[model samples]
Target: MSSSEQPVGEVQVHPQPAPPGSGPWARFVTWAGQDTIEDYSLRYAPKSFRKWSPMACAITALGGIAYLADYSIGASIAVSHGSASAVVAIIVAAVTIFLTGIPIAYYAAKYNIDMDLLTRGAGFGYFGSTLTSLIYASFCFIFFALEGSIMAQAMKLALHIPLALGYVLGSLIIIPLVLYGMTALAKFQVWTQPLWLVLFVAPIVFIATADPKGFNGFLTWAGDGGTERVTAIGVGAGAGVALSLIAQIGEQVDYLRFMPEKSETPPWRWWSAVLAAGPGWVILGAAKQICGAFLAFYVAGKVGFTAATEPIQQFLGGFGSVLHNDTVALAVATIMVLLSQVKINVTNAYSGSLSWSNFFSRVLHIHPGRVVWLGLHIAIALALMLGNMFAVLNTILGFYSNVAIAWIGAIVADLVINKPLLKLSPSYVEFKRAYLYSINPVGFVSMMVGSFFSILAFYNVFGDFMAAWSPYLALALAFFLSPVICILTKGKYYLVRPNPIREEIEKEPLWAGQTLLDIVDQKRYELPDMVHDCPFHGGTISSLTCTLTKCHDLCKTSAYIDSVTTATLRNAAEPQPTT
Candidate 1:
């Protein structure tokens, strides 16, 4: 028998000590690190913590897409570039988002990791993913400000509050709710879903019933372009703006990581939850955009084209059709706007916290906890809200789409093509800092090259046509370049060392319900729950290593092996008595 296959009875088990430091600051940090609140921001989410049912996790994820920003985006696109162009643009963007989101969402749920962690193993490597983390964080705060702006507009209409003060109030209200993380968010989203659905659907139903002719008029509306025919530039520009939402898959995976393991849940239930909550979010999002375009057309005569893009006005006009009383309609409209914005902004804030946590932890090597970053994220969003970011929303989103799609495209290529087809990257994700290179050229170089040329195209360096089509250019380059670069580099940068735990698993397979001892912390962990690589040692460790003891340095090359297998190997090696 090998030394590693020694008898289980011969091995000694030692209990690990508590985390260092008992100061007030340390205590506060400890408090913030609570599993119920922090939700494993910096590491793999173990099976023990992913207790929520797949359906429940899916609902929570879907609830985040309830932002009223889609209404504004759709309305703006339709008004700027005719209904025909808007329809094509919305469909194209939705299809791209749905297809790209599938591989990312499936990998996240299967691996029990977030986007940042997934990026590390996919191709970007350890530090290369930090840039994507910044991109994702920017997505969260940008949308938070946008959603907060909508809420402020509703407050201004309902209570006659000033927009500046309303922005502050709107941003502040979500702080308390998000401070507790997934524990608070899951319950809150599920509880409010029924009401949000009713409010969301009622206005569309009422508008269709009361104004049948208005729907037809919306179809013929030529917009500011004064042409119903779909031009290439119009489709491209509108799609660019809509594609800014591609990063939303990051937010979806944040909740999908909490889904119960596939082995634990029924196969049908598992896939259904993943698809429904993952890429399926864009289905409702696209419908909402089309509905917003129609609503904008319905109210365009009463309010000017510019004012029609505002969600507050759209809902007010929708409710006015149903409720004859102007005061009641205004009140109901304001309530719906508030409800929608609140649901989405909380998600924005929560996902932003996780992104910021990942970014700064790698950069500064110090994590004050996700709650501190939560405050930072909200502050940045508040600043944007006060700056009237909603006024130039299309311009900002159009430009941002170039970089956002490049990041997502590179990830998708690595997941769908490189790992599966070329077999350059590993089949499994390796996110531990100990095993990953600081950066990998396959994904990092592809994103950089894609973003550089796309930005130039966006600025009209090539031509007006190329400028409008820059986002697609970015997507294609990143997607194709990832595999080419992987081939050129030969995948040497993917891992610093072979994963010893995985090597051991290949030698002797572990089954469910089996118990294994963690050699470092000396704790017993069940089969699948103990399979995670230790962030410090780059070998198998107890899932609770960092959380239970907060000790990273003490473990060196630790691994989990089955006690029964060790005993059998030991018995076979010993001399048989008088045989």
Candidate 2:
């Protein structure tokens, strides 16, 4: 044996490998999804694969967030709290989301990593991020169920399809669309952008111009409960409900990971693309919510409050106002609903698949590819749809907003507060499994403390006022506690092992356009920093060890090259000796 060679068992394997296809229905699962593209579920994205310009990538990401749920959220709040209070809550939520999203999006784009990977590096640690994945996965499916329900409503009105069948069709339609992952999603979002904008905006404009009286009335509308005054309680409650969307930034960064490097692009263009596609999404989203409120008020006057909450019914009233022809109005309303829901649900399924991939990979040590998770995600959402999740939308969002806000707030605190102010966490985002702790208390403890107390408040354990302020309490606790925990723990738990050598290699100029296979095949010179997961060995090992006879044949198989290897090859190819 060579002096540099180490036995495979030297690298510890946690939880074992499930005895090679031992999970329930493992064979069927492996057969169902494409394994060719790993989607960088567990690591950084390499430069060679980042083909899109910043502008194109930003727009594609923004397309996924362009859902009609804003309208639904806005309408639901307005219906309960009145227009003035709902408007206040919408503004607060928008500003909060926009501000926090900036740092997260920038990191994801700059590092070529997704939200899960970003979270791991930011503070959650490797397996610690698994909990967050479940949180984010829940966000995806919750929204998926909401968006799917909206589509089902559209189908019922247009094609006279039953809600149950429509639910199945809506959930199933996204499966094929999302099956191809970001490649198909980017094109789908781009081509549909123009049509979606037209359908989305045209009716609102028509309503404003044609129905002057209704438009005027919408501005001063009060809640059905006769809450005309905008109290702090009402605003807090409304904001909490709307704040359930704070984690949508995760979905935005999912696509932003594919953004072209800023070094190659003009400064103005890069910043503009990042801002517009990142936190800037909330600007338009906030406007949509306010617009939803207006439409809800207008529809309420015509068809009563209960029916007014339905986007299909609300838009139908708007179209009917101008079109006069009932059949034509129904057609336009249905088309708008279908287009909007389809666009957003595809994003939901895609993001969910990524979250689930991050989760299952860490917990189960199984990677069946993202498509299988996509199916599993849609299946869960379909069940939620069948249960009629939309009917209790307010209850669902009100409770969910706390956990979502806690997750986002903890990340935001780490990025904006803990990293810079306290210097408690590392500056660079380190996501590779071999380098991170299984859990990090800074984020996990803060999130737990925040969620636990807030959920208590939500259930009225502390009484009515605290119940109404639960989401805010969650946000405040998580944001404030993150830095506190970091200080106390001295950020010791952030890394279970020393930083990987790839961190230094990534900074080297000669690292690009190289792969582990190149070294193993003797196509390129071996460097100490060129690391890859050896097929014969479970852990990431440097190409310097590629000469070992036991691992020589395994390195030839490209599938065993792993997702992180290409990234390491492309970004950190050139290595320099340590001082």
Query: Best lDDT goes to which candidate?
Result: 1
Q: Report the lDDT tens digits of candidate 2 across residue range 1-579.
A: 331352221111111123365575554344332222345444455565567888789889999877888899999999988998889989988988888899998988877788988888787886678888998999999999999999999899889999999999998888878876677888899999998888778778887788777777554578677377677877888888889998899999988998876666798988898899989889989998998888889888777887778899988988888999989999999988988898999889889998987787666555556767888999999999999889899899999999988888889899998888888787767776545666888998888899999999999999888988899899899999999999999999886544445555557634543444333323222222234454555544533232222333454344544554676676787776699
Reference-based lDDT, residue 239, model 2: 85
Candidate 1 deviant stretches above 4 angstroms: 1-27, 503-579
User: Which residues of candidate 2, in runs, are more than 4 Å off?
Assistant: 1-37, 505-514, 517-579
- Residue 448, candidate 2: Cα error in Å is 0.5
Worst lDDT 10-window in candidate 2: 7-16
Model 1 poorest ten-residue lDDT run: 9-18
- Superposed by TM-score, candidate 1 places the C-alpha of residue 217 at a distance from the truth, in angstroms, of 1.9
